[model samples]
Target: MNLTGGIVLYAVLWFLTLFILLPIGLVSQEEAGEVVPGTHAGAPHRADLGRKMLWSTVISAVLWGGCAWLILGGVFTREDVMNWDQLVR
Candidate 1:
């Protein structure tokens, strides 16, 4: 893949990973019995976004590395995806 393609792929993977990780181990104010007066009960008691983001980056790097290897390696090429229907037929 080209530089832009690799960047876009990693960005997409990063956000997807972040969203996937967002709900894990979360403790909502309601669930924790500590709902603040002016906030939604479902709001996280402690989002810990910096740690989540760091983990997301690490996880996405591993995934992106695998995907990049698949794309850049000789195992598969863009042409294989583009002509998948014919290949299946």
Candidate 2:
């Protein structure tokens, strides 16, 4: 993959990882019994975004490394992906 492709892949992986991690270990304001004024009860009592973001970066980097290895190692090519239907025959 080219530089742009690698960057895009990492970005997608990062966001996906972040979303998946977002709900884990969450504590809603209502559950914590400290709902701020005008805020939804479901709002996080302590989002801990910094820690989540750090974890996301670490996980995304590992995934990106594996993906990069696959692409660079020639395990599959663009044609393989594009002609996936033919493999069923």
Candidate 3:
């Protein structure tokens, strides 16, 4: 893949990662009943949620980074990259 392709791939991956994570963060807050305004009582759950989010963020980053590297480095051709059929088989 070219530079532009790599940028687009990275952007998409980052967006996907954030998309998956933001909801989890929201749900964690909601579960902890910390979504209400001007409240700070759920510090323990909030911290736990933050840790979960952090781990998820790190895993997503690493996975996507590896995929991007393999794709852009020509380890997999553009046609083969992210091909669900190929992966499923």
Highest-scoring model, TM-score: 2
Please give the CA lDDT of all the candidate structures: 0.93, 0.97, 0.64
Instruction: Identify the candidate with maximal lDDT.
Output: 2
Q: 1-89, model 2: which lDDT tens digit per residue?
A: 99999999999999999999999999999999999999999999998999999999999999999999999999989888999998898
Runs in model 3 deviating more than 4 A are 27-61, 72-74, 78-89
Candidates in order, TM-scores: namely 0.90, 0.93, 0.46
Clashing pairs in 3: none
What ranges in model 1 sit over 4 Å off?
A: 87-89
Candidate 2 stretches greater than 4 Å from native: none
Q: Each prediction's Cα RMSD?
A: 1.4, 1.2, 6.1
- In what order do the candidates fall by lDDT, top score first? 2, 1, 3
Write the number of the candidate with greater TM-score, choosing between 1 and 3: 1
lDDT by residue (15-84, candidate 1, tens digit) is 9999998988899999999999999999999998889899999999999999999988867877788888
Q: lDDT of candidate 2?
A: 0.97
The true-versus-predicted C-alpha distance at residue 12 of model 2, in Å, is 0.5
